[model samples]
Target: MNAIAFTDVSRSYGNVLAVDGLNLTVETGRTVALLGPNGAGKSTSINMLLGLIRPSGGRIELFGRPPEQAVARGEVGAMLQDGELIPELTVRELVDFVRGLYPEPLDLDAILQMADLTDLAGRRAGKLSGGQSQRVRFALAVAGAPRLLVLDEPTAAMDVESRQRFWAAMRDYAAGGRTVLFATHYLEEADENSDRVIVVARGRVVADGTAAQIKAKAGGHAVRFTLDGQSAAGLDALPGVSAVEVTGGTATLRTADPDATVAALYRGTSLEIRDLRLAGADLEDAFLALTREP
Candidate 1:
């Protein structure tokens, strides 16, 4: 069965539409990333899946059941961006409290080790730093031994090292055949960790596929080179070159065919090019290009 499914789902607040006719499905054991700029309805969609809010139109199903029913059975665990840890409770205490709410929770020691919180188990929740608190939240999310884990900006306040460790733990968790759906602005996170990426723009999904497929939606390859005193005025007119930008001695070209563009450049230009480089679009580049206002 699919882990999650949304059929023509939409949500609105008064005159503002947050999610518009979103149709998506996530198979069991898949790690998917929901990527979008601010106000792109990522949070709205997540909220609906969590049963925190009702969709204005269409339907949503979690593991072939209503979202609320699945959640009630401890099938889903979520770490939202805005919740706060209760004050005065120690890290271990907070985790224990949440674990008790579920029928079958993970072992306390294992949870602590997985979240890298064994050292801070006795630390007061309110006394922890932002990154540390985030880790505690992660621990709580997994305490229920849920089938579906949902994280919204899970590494927002974490440092580089913390982010890496957190993802490692997440990878381990998902390796057990659990489904993971995370919404993140970090393109590298989506690129490196997620098996699939769904790009939403203006309350709708614009692209959905593997990381490479999403990047391909933006265009082909980017060719960059530095050539002193060389003009790029005619480069844009080259076959396979879609756009060209020249700044001082540096020229950047967006090309549908990198080999053809490179051959045309060599055949037409005599100026010696320095620092020439060819690279395909990464998630960030594709995101900006695809979501740019037209």
Candidate 2:
């Protein structure tokens, strides 16, 4: 069964369309990364999927049921960007409280261990640091042993170590054949952690595939070499070159057809091409190319 489905989904606020005719699906047990620029409707899409707000148009389903019904049954777990914990409650208290709401909650001790809250289990929510608070939120989200987990910017306040631990925990949870869908600005995280990535722009999907496939889709390859006291002019005019950059004595040309670009470079440029290299585009390069406004 599919974990999520969105068909012709859209959301608008007054004159602005936050999500426009979005169509997507995720099968059971797959980890998907949802990526977009600011105001690209990632949060709006998540809100509607969680039933926090109604979609302005179209249909959505969660595990073959309506989102509200699935949520009511404790089948969906979410850690959003802005949810706040009860200030008066200790970490343990809060986690336990949320666990009691689910039909088959994970063991309290297990939840603490997974979220790495064992040491701070008794700390009051108000006394915790920003990163600590984020961990607490993760604990709450997983307390129910939910089948589908949704996280938005889950590691925003976390340090490097905390982020690593968080992804480990997430991977452990996902290893249980559960589905995970996360939205994060950390493109590296999406590249390293997810099975698939979906990039949105102007409130609609612009790219969807594995990281390698997406990178290939966005000007697939790069040709680089050292320029020995030679002009960098006319590099952009080369066949299949989308962009050209020169830093120090090195020139890098991004191209959809590296073969053509390299042939033209050898035939056209009088510059000495030293230490030449050809490689696939990285995720960051692909992201900038795809999201850059025309």
Candidate 3:
């Protein structure tokens, strides 16, 4: 069965639509990234899946059951972006408290170790640093031994080292055939960690694919060089070239076939081409290209 499913799902607040006819399905054991700029409905989609809010239209299911039922059965776990831990409890106590609510919780010691909270287990929840607090929340998310994990901006508070350790722990947890869905603004994190990426824009899905495939949708390599006395108008007509921009002595070309564009440049242009460079499009490029207003 699919881990999560949304059929024509939508949510609106007053006159503004937060999510619009979102149709998506997540298979078991896949690490999927939901990516979009701010106010793009990613949080709304996640909230609906978590049962925090009801969809205004269509339906949603988790593990072939209603979201609330799946969550009540301890099959779904989530780490949201907000919420403060109880000030009176230590890290260990907080995790223990949450674990007790589940029917089958993971071993307390194992969860602490996995989340790198072993050192801070005794620290009061209120006294811990932002990064440490985030790790403790991660421990709670997995404490129930949930089959599906959802994280929203899971690494927003972490430093570089903490982010590394967090992803490492997540990798280990996901290795056990558990599905993971995370919403993140960090393009590099999505590119490096997720098996599939879903890009949302203006309350709609604009692109969905693997990292390489998404990048390909933005076109191919970008060729930039200093070419004095060259007109960008002619270069824009070159085979495989999609767009061309010229600024003084420099020119940038977006192309589908970099090799062909380069060959054409060498053969068709008499202007001096110095400091030439070719670079493949990355996730940021794809996002910008796909999300641009039509």
Error of 2 at 95 (Å): 0.6
Which sequence of candidate numbers ranks them by lDDT, best first?
Answer: 2, 1, 3
By TM-score, the candidates rank as 1, 2, 3
Q: What is the alpha-carbon RMSD of candidate 1 to the true structure?
A: 3.0
Model 2 poorest ten-residue lDDT run: 211-220
lDDT of 3 by residue, 235-256 (tens): 8887778888888888989886
Candidate 1 residue lDDT tens string, 1-294: 899999999999999999999999999999999998889899999999999999999999999999999999999999998889997999999999999999999999999999999999999988999999999989999999999999998999998999999999999999999999999976668888999999898778888999767765667578899966866577887767888888787888997667777888888766576898998765556767778877
Q: Each candidate: what lDDT?
A: 0.90, 0.91, 0.89
Q: State the local distance difference test value for candidate 1.
A: 0.90
Scored against the true structure, residue 160 in model 3 reaches a CA lDDT of 94
Best prediction by lDDT: 2
Give the better candidate number (1 or 2) by TM-score: 1
Q: Write the per-residue lDDT of candidate 2 for residues 1-294, one digit (tens) a residue.
A: 999999999999999999999999999999999987678899999999999999999999999999999999999999999988999999999999999999999999999999999999999999999999999999999999999999998999999999999999999999999999999766678878899999887778888999766666677588999986789999999998888898988898989778788898989877678899998666566667788777
lDDT of 3 at 92: 93
Per-prediction TM-score to the true structure, in the order listed: 0.88, 0.85, 0.85
Better of 2 and 3 by TM-score: 2
